[model samples]
Target: MTDLELTELVKEISLADFGKAFKHQAMFNRRLRTTGGRYMLQSHHIEINPASYKEFGTDELVGIIKHELCHYHLHIEGRGYLHRDRDFRELLEQTGSPRFCSLVQSKARTKPVKRYIYACIDCRCEYARKIRMNTARYRCGKCNGKLRLKSE
Candidate 1:
């Protein structure tokens, strides 16, 4: 969705869930990485990770907005606003906001499935394996040495 849509969604969530108006600006930040959204203390503005929408769709966007709203409302009320605060936790529960921002990764962005990479303990020869092999049972084909984990 566009930045305007995200802004509107944030406002809607703030009012509907918190019964408080969000007076600050909300915008999409393409540079944001890993984090779903961030609440700026200085400006009281909320910046949402655009990657979140691209990866997890509108539902995820709503959840992130709700989470930021919790921070926004609590901070404005002079209550505990950090994630570790009891008031913040309670407000999150009450407002049905997600406690943590989950990683939103696109399936299309993933590389072809490659499970394991077995390497020779002695020569360091790597072998890509689709299935897990018993290290004790299987030896490296190159030098007949024990294999070690090179990849997950």
Candidate 2:
């Protein structure tokens, strides 16, 4: 959705969920990584990750708006607004907002990881590591046996 649509949605959710008006701006931010949305403490603006709406749809968008609104309202009212604050948690539960938004599947890494397999020469104990290790120096933890590269 457009920034105008997002701002309207934020305002709507704010009024509906918290009985408060959101006077600040709400816009989609492509730079937001890992978080669905963030409430800017200094500007009181809400920035939502566009990837969230694109991946999860309107229901998730509404949920993110509600979550951000919780932060906005609490901070404006001079109450505890941080995630760890009682006021924030209470507002989340009260408004039925999600404590955490769903992960954007598109942003997640889909590449298969390559693992290096090693075996203890004496004990036959095996070990797997993401990075290849020097078998000459690294030994088995179980019996302290010399290790050898088995497979990748």
Candidate 3:
């Protein structure tokens, strides 16, 4: 749906589910990457990832809206709005909102496996690392022994 329709739907959901009006803007944010939606504390605005709807459809969109709305209402009312807060948890349960937003896939590749191995000269303690380490500057954690590049 369009941004305007998204905003209207958010408002309707806010009023119907929370019995409160949503006066802030709700817009599709293409830049949003990992999470389905985010509630901005400073602007009191909700930004939704467009990919959520494209991948998961309307039910997922509604669920995300509900999750953000929990943050929106609790924050505006000066109640606990953070995920760890009791009020936020209770509001989420009361509204049947998802505890976490659905994860969004990205085009970025996974990190390469670690290949470098460093060993302590005195203790033979080994460390696996993805990147090269400066042996001269670094020492073993247990014995402060000199470290050497053991293997790739």
Candidate 4:
């Protein structure tokens, strides 16, 4: 969502749940890597990770919003707003917000490992390759040593 949309969502949640108004900014911060969202204590702004919505959809997005609101409301009211604070934990439980911001697990990679290690028999020069090279035709330039497959 755009910054304006995020602002609206935060305002809505604040009013609905906390009976307060969110007077600060809320935006989707593309730079957020692992955290689903963050509440900026200095700016009193909320930053949501765009990847969270892209990967998990609106339901997940709302949860993140709720999580940030927990921080926002508590901090603005001069109560404990940190995750470890008693007030923060109580507020989260009262608001039914998640204790921690959820993260989108990154996609798994399946690329094959470069399993073969090759070495020149005479010069001991080493090489690594994903695919086995033809040792019969390949030789060490330094010593003209025949290359051999040393390990997989």
Strongest candidate by TM-score: 2
* Residues 92-140, model 3: lDDT tens digits: 9999999976665663347889899999999999999998988888999
Deviating ranges (above 4 Å) for candidate 4: 107-152
How do the predictions measure up, each by TM-score? 0.68, 0.85, 0.80, 0.69
- Kindly list the per-residue Cα lDDT of model 1 for residues 37-147, writing each as its tens digit: 999999999999888788778788888999999889999999999999999999989988898776866522455676999999999999987788889988988899999
What TM-score does candidate 1 reach?
Answer: 0.68
Alpha carbon lDDT at 134, candidate 1 = 88
lDDT of 2 by residue, 17-118 (tens): 788899999999999879999999999999999999988899999999999999999999999999999999999999999999999987876765758889
Error of 4 at 74 (Å): 1.3
- Name the lDDT of candidate 4: 0.86
Selected candidate, larger TM-score, 2 vs 4: 2
lDDT of 4 by residue, 4-34 (tens): 9878888888899888888999999888886
In order, what lDDT does every prediction score?
Answer: 0.86, 0.90, 0.91, 0.86
By lDDT: ranked, best first: 3, 2, 1, 4
When sorted by TM-score, best at the front, the candidate numbers are: 2, 3, 4, 1
Steric collisions counted per model: 0, 0, 0, 0
Q: Could you tell me which residue pairs clash in candidate 4?
A: none
For model 2, name the residue pairs that clash.
Answer: none
- Cα lDDT of candidate 2 equals 0.90
Off by over 4 Å in 2: 109-112
